[model samples]
Every structure is written in structure tokens, then in C-alpha cells.
Target: MKNNLKKNKEISKEQIKNYFTKSVSNFRNNFIIISLSILKNFRTYVYVILIPIAFLMIYSWYTNAYKGDFKPPELFKYMVIPSFAIIFLVNTTVSEWKNSVFLKRIHSAGISRINFFVSLYIFNFLLGIASFLISVTVMSIISLIYFKPSNGTFFSLLGLLEFNDWVGMLYSLFLCISISVSIGVIISGLINSIALSQSITLIFVLFSIVFSDCFLPIDLLSLSKPLTYMSYFVPHKHSVWVGLISASSQEVSWAFENPERPGRIISFGFNLWIPCVTAFLYSTLLLVSGYFSFGWNTKK
Candidate 1:
């Protein structure tokens, strides 16, 4: 009995040492948990649940996008962006926050709050990249099936509706998800209840939809300039912009018969780079904040 107790003590000490010495592991674990949660509870997700509806929605907008002002794919891109913002990050982050003792347990294990944050930020970054690819793949296949490739015109990155723009949109999704997840982590870290987490996540979604140009273009709603600027701070804006870019790609010629709508207009006025940088930076800052929140002593 004495030997058994001694070995168990040594094992506990080693675990503590691992937590303190290798903070990266904590972040990796969180990242993994976030991803698993996404896969695990896809049923609750609107995208996953109503994918047929989403597919139909994407199909309609993509078909309508053929209008000279916008291509079917481009318009559909707009909806997809906000959809991702609301569904993926909100559901995953909030759920994890409420259930996981991620923050408290880490500190108990001897990992520093700052170190945990640093590692999680990196993990979130990589996680975003994976989500980007997954989302794009789903969007592209569904859109192309309906739109049918025309003259093999490739998509461009900056043009809002080009092949390259698709690539940029993919990156934008990656950036946006990171920002969203980071925000969730911070929110979860601060609040103790799953119910609270869900509410906050919903608010974030509402804010994102409002800030996005999809529902109310800045030109149309001149008063929202400040909100538009504020939107820059949110990942939802950038992610939506990327979708707009993919939709606006000029190579396909958005309108089938009516050519009056200017090409690349969506990409013209918007400062696409703002969302990119903001999402990247804000996510990092919030991720760190979440780490600290997790570290707060709970025995109080």
C-alpha cells in the first residue's frame, strides 16, 4: 500500500510538471476539444440541421447572382458568411465554456494563465484554417453544381468574385472563426453557466449580422458608418467580406442577361484588410483574456 501511494504521488507531480513546463499542450487540448464539440453536436447547428435549406438558399442566391449586378455565387456567399459566424463558433465555444473546466483545471495543474493563452491562440489559429477549408469545400461543390462552370473562368482573390477571391474568402473564414472562437473562450472563461454562454453567443451572432454588409450595405445605410467601423472589430465582417469576394468574382460575369451592375463593386468600397487584421488581432487578445479568466482562483 505504501509503495502504491508513493508511485501515485510521483505520477501526480509529473503531471503538474508537464502542465507548468509545456503550456502549448493546454492550448492543443482546448483546440481539440473545440473541434470535437463541433463534430459531436453538429445536429444542433443550423448549417448541419438545415443544410438542405442552406443548400437551397445557396442555390437560389447563386442563381440570382447571375444578374449583371451580382453573380449567383457571390450573393450566396454573403449569406454563407454570416451563417458560419452564427453557427460554428457560437455553438462550439459556448458549449465548451459551460461544460469544460478548461481554465480552472489548467491552473490547478500548475500551468500559468499567460502560457495557456499563448498556446490556445496558436491552436485557435490552426483550427480556423481547418474550418475554412471545410466550409469552402461545402460551398464550392454545392454552388458549382447549380451554376455550372462558365468558360472555365478562374476565381481571383481580391476581385470579390474571382477564383483568387475564393481563396481569400477561405482565408477570411479561417480568420473569422479564430476571432469568433477566441471571443467565445473569453466569454466562457468569464461566465460560469452554459445558459449564459448560449445567450452571449447569440448576442454575438446578432451583432455580427447587423454589422455585416449583406443585410444593409453601408452605401444604403449611411448612418451605420460607425457600426460598420465597429464591425471591423468583429470577425463576422471579414468572414462575410470573403464570401462577398467569392460571390463578386468577375470572371464568371454575375448577371446572365442584365449587365448594368458593375463588376467588383462589393470589393471596391470596403476595406477588406481591416476585417482580416482585426479578426486576427482581436482573437489573439480575447484568447489571452480567456486564459487569464480561466486562471482566476475559484476556491474563493
Candidate 2:
């Protein structure tokens, strides 16, 4: 009896190891497969989306140059990068689901549903980071070539490139992108039609921008107590606040205040780390929700 018990323990240990090993293998294979799909269709993506946005960014900078310095436009700040990242990811996910034939094939091949969702999330998250880097690099080059600070100080662009601040800013951006990607995945997984999914995601992106403090100042929320409380729920508000604060050590009170408009003067006493943590938590929550909510079968 003792010998049999010992043998059972040994078998259990081997089973645990095998389970972990298989999980890792599934994750790796799924990630690689999705990544390869993105690369294979690179040109279609570039022409359809990337190139047009790049030109729009350039034009935005050029127009700003005429007005004063060559700081990136507000559109670039609050919309372009985040919107593009979300759209790209959500589209990719929904497309896969929409392709019934492909979905049936993959299901027949016995791929784990959890692995598929995780791999898709990771692919989009990494791709979002890459897109952010490319956008930053392009803007920096444009600044170098065309931008001239009115005061002959590089402070405008310096905030973006400074190491310590840049690290914080990058973290904030990553959190934002991660949140966006997770939300996209959730939307795509829940919705059945590809076009409908895209439309819903687009509306969500627009709503986030319009309602969030990114375009509208937090001070605007002061007009209504309920609205002010609601603004706290907006993900971009935290991200934008963290990003602006991280970019400069100087009090960012100016960003939230407008003397001409005449509103309540709120103090900038909030800790920067709060938003960073909040955004991360939000992303994790969305990812877990998407994983569970995602359907294994192709039929809605």
C-alpha cells in the first residue's frame, strides 16, 4: 500500500509538470501564429491606415508651425495614436470571428480558447507599444527639422524626451494602450458582426475622447457634481493627468485652468502614481473579463 501511494505521488508531480509545459507551449504557439498573421498582411494595414494617419500628423504639425511652435497637435495627443491602436486590434479580433470558415478550422484543430484570447491580447498590446514608439520617433524627427521654440528653449519637446519623465510618460501610455486593447478585445468578442463591432468600437473611442478630460478639462466637470463624479470613471482622464504630470515637474495647473473661461481653480495635489496604478488595474480587469466573456464557438 505504501509503495502504491508513493507511485501515485510521483505520477501527480509528473502530471503537474506536463500541464505547465503544455500551457507554455500553447501560449507560445498562439502568440507566434497571431504575430505572423499581422506581419503577413502588413502592406494592407500600412496603406489603409498607417500612411494616412502619418500624413495627417505631419499636416497637423505643419499647421501648428504656422500658428507658433511645432508642438504636436491636440488631435495627436488625445485621439490619433490611441484610436489607431484600438481600431487595429479590435478589427483584427473581430475579423477572425467573422471568418466562420477559419474559426471552424481552428476550433477543429483543438486550440484552447483561453490561449487564443491571451495570445490575441498580447499581440495587440505589443503592437500598440511599437505604434507608440514609431509615432514618437516620427514626431521627434519633425520637431528637429521644423520646430523652433519661440523662447529659444526646447522645453516643449524636452518634456517628452527627458529620461525620468519620459519613462513615466511611457508607462502611462502603455497602460492606456493596454486598457484600450483589452476593451477592444472584449467588444470584438462580444459582438457578432465585423462591421457592427468596428462601428461600436469607433463610437466608444469617440465617446472616450469627448467625455474624458483629454479634450475637455476636468474643470468642466465642476459644472455638475454628478458629472464631476462621472469624470472619475473615464480612463483617459487618469491617463491624461498622469501623462501631463509626468511630462513636467512644474505644476500642470495651467492645463486645467483657463482664466478667460473663469471657472473653479482646482489644486494639482494628486499623487502621480495613483493614475498609473488605476489604469493598470483597469486593464487587468478588462483582460480577465474578456477572457471569460469570450466565446469559443464562432456563432455569436
Q: Which one is best on TM-score?
A: 2
* Runs of candidate 2 exceeding 4 Å displacement: 42-44, 47-52, 55-84, 151-156, 159-164, 215-229, 254-262, 265-269, 298-300
* Candidate 1 lDDT tens digits, 86-205: 344544554564465754565677755565556555555554455444555555454454444442211321233445665765666555656565666666666666676668777876
TM-score of decoy 2: 0.79
Give all TM-scores, in the order shown.
0.58, 0.79
Candidate 1 residue 179 Cα shift, in angstroms, is 1.2
Residue-level error in angstroms, candidate 1, position 133: 2.3
Write the residue-wise lDDT of candidate 2 on 188-254 in tens digits: 7777777787788778776776555544444565555566566667666566556656654434443
- Summing lDDT over every window of 10 consecutive residues in candidate 1, give the lowest-scoring window: 151-160
TM-score of 1: 0.58
Error of 1 at 250 (Å): 11
Q: How well does candidate 2 score on lDDT at residue 99?
A: 59
